[model samples]
Target: MALVNQTGSVFWSSNKSTTVVNTVAQLLDNGNFVLRPENDENPEKYIWQSFDHPTDTLLPEMKLVWDLKSGINRFLRSWKTNDDPATGDYAYKLDNRGFPELVIFNNETIHWRAGPWNGKRFSGVPQMKGVGIMRFELQENSDEISYSFEMLNTSLYSRLVINSSGIMQRFVWVEGAKFWNQYWYFPGDKCDNFGECGPFGICNANPAQMCNCTIGFRPKNQQAWDLRDPSDGCVRSSKLDCGSDRFLPFKNMKLPESSKAFVDQTMNLSVCGEICKKNCSCVAYANMKITQGGSGCVMWGGDLIDMRQYDDSEDGGQDLHVRVAASDLGMFSIAYE
Candidate 1:
């Protein structure tokens, strides 16, 4: 029997001969299935390669590639349940927003975002630091965008899996303990909730003030904001003169959602800011580098989304320069400094 859906299709076979085999061997070490010719060394060139066909787990050395020209992307789809291998509602893919970024989806809705790749890790995932047992990479070109990881030290076995609850987790295999140790998981807290604070609003889940508007901006609905409904977001306090507007530097912050931004790989931060200022729609700008001594720039032209304040001591976050009325600059200058 076969069932077809808008985004995916499924097929099933009842015959035992067609589905099962007696000589097949499954290896847990490499997650590969192979069939051998009695005494052959290479196992008949792999009857089934798990790398070609993936479920919800992404193992080391396996590539998650996308072809922009063909509109084809390869990524992990969560299983319906622990017992069922059927595709679930959640999916993980590299999204071509303003810049190429990693996004998790629950059906058509965005479940969470990893922000854009800033020459290191995703801007939103600052905790993915330190010399780990695995090294991750985000590759992008005119043809495609792909996410892959490699084992830095072979002795330390690590794996990334999308669980039934829609959380992506990294686990390390402990040989001595004979169990998997949890390393990290996505959606760390309320701040990790996708677009929780709505457009132009920033969320700092574990902060004295969890949600607030950016500098030079004010809550669109003060009543709604007091009631903990930040969906109204923030709006500019005063109109930008466009001629005298200057970018107010905001240091030690996580960049806003990239989807609303305009990006140019060739431009530096200063030039990018100038380009944004010239346009009345430009709201903010940030460097593309995710490390110390950052370079390049990503500029936002619309409302900022999915922004949060992060603990700089735990993760190396970036700074953002937000546009403001030149007259209002003096009022907020001390706070920014």
Candidate 2:
């Protein structure tokens, strides 16, 4: 069967091998296009669904997923142009590496990241924490990894889209205004750009100098850093002394990139510190869940990338303990014991 437009052009065609006499197709209120037997209304028994194959827009309840067992990745890709429905250069998908996180890609390269889920919201998007209209969820297991959000009020309309210019933004219907209003946007500032300050550098959005080395570290290229170029990142001012190294407490921090991370949900903050202390490669650590006094452990073994410092007044972000040599700690170090 095929769906044709007014111009007699076939926009969609079904290739089902067996045809049922009483099959029916319906457009659900949640934007799902489902094909099922007319007598059956069970969504689980539907033969096929448009939600399983997404294009540019991600409406409420639509999942952005990665099937670990089958290697099938369902994500949103932007249209080439406002007038063109062809595939564009930007894609928003769930990136399952050391830990699962939402990321926007410019073609195949990472452009922006929403950080990892911390039991509440993405570590980088603190705005998701207290959202009253939307409830976000992230599920990870042996079979698959998925990220999705649902509106609390069924009467409301909202959507998340990766636009042609590579910007990921969320919009909500303004019933009174008779138009869609942008609710949120990623790459909100220079600091939101992936690895904006390279590795071991913390980006602070408020200052004239937006990038700086974390406590106990120094710019790898002092001359370049002085010239407002921090692409070279930073290095330890003193070599790590392994067992004798101290942790510098960086409060209100966006956890670093976790492409090479170690996670232990059963561990606590103190034990997590000991675990990192024992492993010479472990450079930083943070609690995986920030609610109810915090819990779990996530440690980074290599250069800490894509980190940012939030203002003390900011509602989102967690504390991160960065390993530094005892001699380099100076006044920046906080007592970990």
Candidate 3:
């Protein structure tokens, strides 16, 4: 069912509702249109809400969620075109399989990823750390996992949307200019494409050769790599010696894809490293939070993917400790040393 405005545009849409007598509809201050029992003033008991079934735009205070109990996922889908409101080919959603990460999909295929939440922001989106006007939140519990943001100033308006062109963009309303200014957009560069450098490869936006193997690894197919293709990624130069392998630190790194990772929020960084060392399949580990010198633990198993290195001057990228053979440690110095 959809609510049509005076101008004939869809004001809101949701699943068809059963007819109920004496129900009341109200638009709340936070922009939620809710249906409730006439005598009930509580939001928690609302029978339905527009915010729960958003279209393309993610308004302030609107949540993109995954409800574990119901197995329902709420996400943004781009419109087919600027003039048509039909469902489009792109979607912006949260992947909660392991550690949760924001990902954009073109139909069934991944287009880009805004890596896992690292306490302050998504690990891959460094610019989010610098946005002072918006207060972001990531909530995870036994019942649900969700992400949302609200403007600090009530007078300001901003919306995050997946456009028809398949780009995720944020726009802020400019009062004086009487227009919505594009604040940010993602798939920001060639490197931002999902797994642009494939597994065990690191991408640098500023480099002429955008993709390179991590320090202790070599291109899996040098011939393909020399021809400007790196889809095959890299392989370890020396096989890990199980018990004696070292975790080589890489600073200012966009942590690898996390859907197959292991996470323990109770553990510290040092304990996290020890846990990774014990697992033969563990490829990398990093802190979950970069605040107050860092806290929590996240360890990745199997090959690492979609990793990128940011400039040293950037504020938010985290350190990733990659497992390498002891013999290979002598070849590459610890990053940032």
Cα-based lDDT for every prediction: 0.75, 0.87, 0.87
How would you encode candidate 1's per-residue C-alpha lDDT over 84-189 as one tens digit per residue?
A: 8789988887787777788889988999988778887877887776746678898878988889888888777888888777899988898999999988899788
RMSD after Cα superposition, model 3? 3.2
**TM-score, cand. 2 vs. native:** 0.95
What's the C-alpha lDDT at position 260 in model 2?
A: 69
Error of 1 at 225 (Å): 1.4
lDDT of 3 by residue, 188-279 (tens): 99889988888999999898999998657999999999998999999999978878788888888888888888888889998888878998
Per-residue lDDT tens digits of candidate 2, residues 1-337?
A: 5689999998887665446678888999999988898889998888888999899899889999999999999999999997798999999998898867888999889999888888889989977876899899999888999988999999999998888988888899999999999998888999999998988999999988999986578999999999988988999888888978988888878888886688888899989998888999988899988878899999998889899988877766788999889877665456642
Estimate candidate 1's alpha-carbon lDDT, on a 0 to 1 scale.
0.75
Models ranked on TM-score? 2, 3, 1
Instruction: Supply candidate 3's per-residue lDDT for 3.
Output: 77
Worst 10 residues of 3 by lDDT: 328-337
Q: Could you tell me the TM-score of candidate 3? A: 0.91
On TM-score, the leading prediction is 2
